[model samples]
Target: MKIEKRWIISFLIISAAAIAGLFWPEAVETPEILSQFGKTEDIVPADVAWLLTASCLVLLMTPGLSFFYGGMVGKKNVISTMLQSFICLGVVTLLWVIVGFSLAFGDPIGFHIDGRFYSVVGNPFSFAFMDHVGVLPHLKMASTIPFMLFALFQMKFAIITPAIITGSFAERVRFISYLFFICLFTLLIYAPLCHSVWHPNGILGTYFGVKDFAGGTVVHMSAGFAALAGVLVLGKRKNSSHIPTNIPFVLLGTGMLWFGWFGFNAGSALAANGTAAMAFATTTTASAAAMLTWIFFERLNGRKVSALGACVGAVVGLVAITPAAGYVTVPQSIFFGFITAIVSNLVLNAKAMKKIDDTLDVFACHGVGGIMGMILTAIFAQGENASLLHGGWNVFAHHMMALLLVSAFTFFGSIILFRITNAIIPLRVSEASEQLGLDISQHDESLDPNRHVPMTILDLAK
Candidate 1:
């Protein structure tokens, strides 16, 4: 037979098998609630309440990240690190509503406006957000708000993503450059990538049918790699001995973030139903498993597990199970948590081997954790054609490939963006700023007075 004929035959056979699987009856199945009209009430008030709550929980993560990053840097840079998240929360909120949403979720342009430039993958403006049509909450998906509210939740994501980058350059980056990149990164990088991943018509959703339940690939991996990119561009911090500036601060941030994880995971369900309940359970389970695993490993080194280790372990577990939470069983959640903590620990410790200095260990915690979650998702997933354990080996290879591809794309794009930013503006600050601290040099405010000041919407907004 001709080679072309052989290829065609193989393709047809695979297509037939997938179709067969698609149409196959489940041995044990829940009653299907298929809907054609997509009941509007699917976005019920309760679900809306849940979504709004989840959105707030997710927002809490930024300050959590800020504290996490701030504690890792030297005292001089502590306030600056925290401010990154605060500023991003304020800025990205406005950016997303105005343009990020439109670019990310807008209808594809007709190439007629200002001659295709208007649509060049979402207005090429370095600062402008993608075109946003409006908030759209789908009844079938269980969102209670308009599409705009959903977009706002996602904007928090965009805000936090670039904020993660600050950790890599903590104690060393120029405040102005940090601001510049947040806007650039959100507008040019995050918007398009989010569109590609979440937009129904994007290539990943329409063609590949990729499933990212709650930002294993989109938020965690993307931000982690961007941290790596920034680290590559801006070298390590000056001092060598002092690892963390304040363990207490780190613990504080960790607590806030843990509280927020509920929203991040359960809210993805976009409803106040069984699925959200499942996510809530899984989120806690995975975090505990990861924390235990971390402490266990620390004890092995003839050392008691410190507060930092505990928080780090919990974060790893949280990231690892995020993608799998809604679909996998409880057992899988525990397993993923254990494995992610151990793996991230190893990667984090091996940093001395490389010249790259990921200041906050973003790659170790978020990047590796996302990969672990994605891989385990293939094993634990259930339902139609789920991979082994859930769907089996047949689906495993594809999911693994997807993880690597996502990581590579994020790493390369971030590298390019970082290099460009570095070339145009200094990425790091002078020795003077390094010694004085970012709070005073960058924002002229101090976290010292954080509580004394009245709590405005701005304060909680982060």
Candidate 2:
């Protein structure tokens, strides 16, 4: 049979279409035996509109995260924190277009679902999707948009990841080190891992049966571990004890994050129908639960819950639900959010228990929450293969183990990259720079009223 180039690309994509089946610990294969409805030629405009909107929504989350993170830090560091998220959008978007997407979805790249690549499976060089010069590849899940838009949406995930790392080294990191870490982390740490879980040709499906409705494992846990590694490398901020800076900004950031998240979770459904509506419901419920949980814990354990606790609780809920948004019920989501709030908050407060100096509790919130989501997905996924809970419950432990492996992989990669970036350029600001604060030291600006002219009626008159 003579194979057209288009056919070759399509065939190659079809062969490599199941990466998350491996360490997924419990992938929902929709086993051939279970039954499936054949593809309909009917075009769905609603689905298309939903996906396009969702991509934009996910993109907005970067700035939303910036505001959230910036508010938590001192006034001196606001722009720096926001800049980290914004820069991630620029760099990772470029990288994904060039090679990150292909690296993840193209070939095995030495990763396997079990131990070896199967015949139906393939190597990067062997896959048509791997060849950037061929006709653009298409995914059934998102055929409505230009593949470019799909790539852009996924790129948002990569962008926000390193931004999560900013919380660990916020006050003291050098700009050069920050740039160094962000570039390398997106490529080495994030790319392959994304391939493992989301890439059509991934190990997650081939090896373990991990089920991440969104990014409980990849985005949250991975970034959380990176946060831990970052603080370990950078040490604590100069001032550790007090409120350190502004509390009002943190509240403002949290509000914006909550607003933008409607798009983040609902949009993940990649459609605007029932599942997306369900995700929207769970997202709101879990956030509310986590926030109240934090206040209760604070009142019981500490003197009172501060502005920081409320904001962080909201974030933890968001992180925990990311991986299981479409799969679990609201009751399960509430359980997931509440548990994550308690656990992550404790880890952060356990402070000084380990020498690592996380600047803003990234690991406690994002990392821990992500792990909790991934594990619960295995327990609560209700469709297709569902979890063993559909019948038996043996797979729960396997789910935890998978999260651990992914966390370990992300942590080690982060540490190695941190060391390499440190060697290339110092990873921290000079003591003088730290004293000056990143906005002034790195960007050479400030929030001071005297620094710039105010926009008054007289100024407009000019």
Candidate 3:
């Protein structure tokens, strides 16, 4: 078999870059930058080690998501579904290195209005092409690890955010359109949101004092709401039949995601200290609690508890506790998990009753769960001056305002993006393609050799 041209080109490019990095070093400007910042502020070895480890862990989530999503779609669409998530590893990584990271973490560019610092986004030029992002600590972001590692860690989050939205439309989407939409969404939606919540001079954190420990607001909330916008724009999958093609695949994916999440939540602390320890503990406790709660809810609703339900509930728990991980105790995390799991289950049921085609219930699980987590984070926050329970309603009010802003921005912004992407390349495949399945229609690949491809949905309807 001959290697594909694209694969050969990719291999050569990566080989060249790796060799250059190893030998020249200055080609990437890493060594010179380190020398310029010689003897700069304290850098802890443990923190560096942990952060590097965490970044690797977070990078595993995309493929894990692939299996999780692929198993849910029919066999004909399985490859296409999985590829949607897997492709992000390449698309978003390049985008992040070139511009996405700078747009998120660079110095602010907005002007002051009425004595309030209103920052719209970071300056792309600040770290453009990875300039000024090297071995030295960024100090403001994470003090121990190389600044580049922080950007890489955050890139994993950026990559996975749009991947989450793919579940909303799944098999119906045109692959080219999906690609364009993710790139646009990363820059317009994910980057700006990341700057707003995580950047020191961001509008939400600097002016409104909102606390998002690890992307409950930026990652899950934005993706969830954006997913809501997606389903609305794409409408429903034609000839829709929701069934799991591989329960075992789903189980495997869930295992990988859960394993990776320790790094996702705990790694956000950016240190190997008490905060990281607490985040790790809470992450595990919340996931466990949510999984059990979801099964209990299923039983109460007169349905048999299932592995899929357990997987979804556990993911919901992870989403909910993300914001509260560094801020709340393990017990509060358990509460967060239980509450979000129950609420997501109810919302999923409601969506089914209302006949909304959310595909895999992205909105119900991530959107609703994230909002619940954000609210609970405000209430159960641990610091004496941070939490509504301990301090006052001010923190709670800030979180409430932040939630509204995020929800509106992601929903409306995503609608505009969807329309724009749809205009450039039609969002959905033709009726014939839909009937043929994306594996054969778009990719010309299929899992089953003997499976016949139908001519059209009209024929199936007849």
Candidate 4:
């Protein structure tokens, strides 16, 4: 279809939906608690304001990631690589609104046949189409923000998680297949992990007391491990060249991701309180420390400090601190950043030596960093809650157990998902098409407008 016709159709459909929404029974009422400005309220306005702002910041990270990943790929595949992340913004958001949120955060379903299953996942029907997820504060969850806002905030995380995996098979995967796999991944892998770790009655949280201040396990580790699986399934790119097309774009993406990460970590606090403040401070400290540590290590390895190394190191720091941001102090985060940068750097080097084609080092940065963060969080998590450093042996043990379980589940489950998606739509593109470049073969687009010179009437007639 022509682009103009497509836009007209989309506009008409959206306009019709807006008109229909105005006539529907008013199920979504602004809560009385939020309406009162001058009096004491159940929902704090400050919390609402902060959470909303944080949500927007988190949303920006996906495009930031697109640029980051895009710049790292060959110029021939940059648009294809970027679109893989950009499409998640649209595809994942729709999936979340439909049933994804319910599956991850709706009321837990209990079984009494034995002791209790407690809920493997939230009741999908309970909040299907966001039935009760409205402006009213969901007392069971964040009590200060609208339930709808909370869901929307969570949606940003959902959008970015699968986007993270595209780095694994950037140049070789078919775009349609990529889209299907991410959608399937969100429902099968991402949602279940989110429910298990974050939901109040979740197995890991309620039964194991595994603490993930943000999404060490759910987002970072899952994406990382799943990325490993994707690399294994998709195999190596035909041209496994490590040449980066755009260092400046990588820097821009790094800056955006670093900015967005404040929301990614602090927003998990769900309240504008001391915890949020602590999280923000720790996130900043950890990222800076990691960036410096990475370049320092590069110098030691006899390689000149490069822009790509700094960006990757900064990102690794952000991943390492995510699980500990709200729980640990700034000094602890400095250690977290420094240690994680070293660990990821070592693993990345090993991966390159082994010739593993995990493009962009998703597993090395997110997976390894997240596991390190989870373990560190158990050691240094301060406050009233006890950590291993404070004699909380059981909590430490549970986090270790949770880490293993999450790693195994994500890795194996992603393999199964890749096979399933591949059965329906071939995952890898034809070698001929890949040689021609995904930009021209798949999308008929390119970063350089001059790649296709204009054809004269004589050429067209020919």
Worst window of 10 by summed lDDT in candidate 4: 453-462
User: What tens-digit string does per-residue lDDT give for candidate 4 at 79-129?
Assistant: 999999999998888778777998999767654335756566788866666
Q: Residue-wise lDDT of candidate 1 within 1-462, one digit each (tens)?
A: 224353466467557655754665443312331221133554467867777888988899998988887887776567778887778887777667556776776554423433322232434332133222234354332246665457667766787788776766677787656766777788777777676567655554333445677878778888888888788778766653456879998899888888988888888887688988888888889999999999999899677879989989998999998887898778778988998999998898894624576767788898888888877777777787676665456567667766677778888888888777777667777655555555655555665665332334223221
Alpha-carbon TM-score of each model against the true structure: 0.80, 0.81, 0.90, 0.89
User: How much lDDT does each candidate structure score?
Assistant: 0.72, 0.71, 0.86, 0.86
Name the regions of candidate 1 deviating beyond 4 angstroms.
Answer: 1-43, 108-144, 351-354, 392-394, 444-462
Candidate 4 lDDT score relative to the true structure: 0.86
Evaluate residue 80 in candidate 1 and report its C-alpha lDDT on the 0 to 100 scale. 78
Candidates 3 and 4, the one with greater TM-score: 3
Worst 10 residues of 2 by lDDT: 126-135
Candidate 4 residues lying further than 4 Å off, grouped into runs, are 1-40, 110-117, 351-353, 453-462
lDDT of 2: 0.71
